[model samples]
Target: MKRESSLKRATTETDVSLALNIDGSGIARISTGVGFFDHMLTLFTKHGKFDLNIEASGDKADNHHAIEDIGILLGKAFYEALGDKAGINRYAFQFTPMDEALCRTCVDISGRGYLVFDVPLTREFIGDFETELLEEFFVAFTANSKMTLHIASLYGTNNHHIVEGIFKSLGRTLKTACAIEAGNTEIPSTKGIIE
Candidate 1:
């Protein structure tokens, strides 16, 4: 069976449509009107080996709302795709490096939403993408996905590389955590249920 989900959200601030395939060949089709964000999402998809498609539009004032809403939808799609979470690894972590920057991302699909983001970005923006929105995206995603996510920038100077490493680590981590384990047919939890 294909592990996939899709969703669409419309609010006063933005409108976002997203589709995700947890088991895929790393194909991405993204258009958020934020070039740098598009690049980040593309790389993320490629690293995770997940197919993702996103189309979003936000207010003319800024693109923050669109990205955050995308996070919300993306998280929902993942939750829906995982279903009962049977046989999934359920926990994973990754350390990714881009140039001189390194980031660590960890995740646990315990159906309890939490986030611990500690990336220090000095730059206010990466191209047209605001650095502040990076945390917002993860925050929104973690909350909506009902997962525990911890991201830490071990070291980084270049803002672009720092952000890239974070997203890449996140992608790789989730990819591992969502994988189905061989010969394991039950949920990977002692509680008998994730929630």
Candidate 2:
């Protein structure tokens, strides 16, 4: 069974379309107009071993509209794909090291949207992507995916390395959490339901 979702959200503001697959080989076709953002997202897909495609257009004058809209679209897709959250691992954690940086990430696919992000960048921006946008990405992802996420950069000197560690860590964690467990059709939570 292949689960997928497509969403379009528009005001006078922006238009975004996002589609995702929970069980897929790593493949990505992304266009967000923000080059660095696209790169990070591509890494996200590749590392997470997910197939994802996104096309978004918004007021370039304000990156906020485009960024937030993508979040909304992705959230909707995750919620749709997990429908009832049966037979999933439901929880995962990872600690990844990228050269000098180390990041730890944990997630619970419990139909709850909560995020704990802790990474203080030595610089305000990396390329055109603001350092703070990392937070926005997780906030949006958790909210849309209806999952609890915790990300922390335990040690890193370079801002780029730090952020890269976080994304890679998250990707690996999600990859594990979403894996299908054979012969298990119940929510992994002890409560019988993830909600």
Which is the leading candidate under lDDT? 1
Candidate 2 on 83-147: residue-level lDDT in tens? 77788788999999989999999999988899998887878778888777778877887898889
Could you tally the backbone clashes for each prediction?
A: 0, 1
- Per-residue lDDT tens digits for candidate 1, residues 99-189, read 9998999999999999999989999989999999998999999999999999999998899999989888888999999999988889988
lDDT of 1: 0.93
In model 2, where is the ten-residue run with the lowest total lDDT? 2-11
TM-score of each: 0.98, 0.95
Q: After superposing candidate 2, which stretches have Cα over 4 Å from the reference?
A: none
Kindly report the root-mean-square deviation of model 2 from the true structure over all alpha carbons: 1.3
Clash pairs (backbone) in predicted model 1: none
- Evaluated at residue 53, the lDDT of candidate 2 is 94
Q: What C-alpha lDDT, on a 0 to 100 scale, does residue 140 get in candidate 1?
A: 91
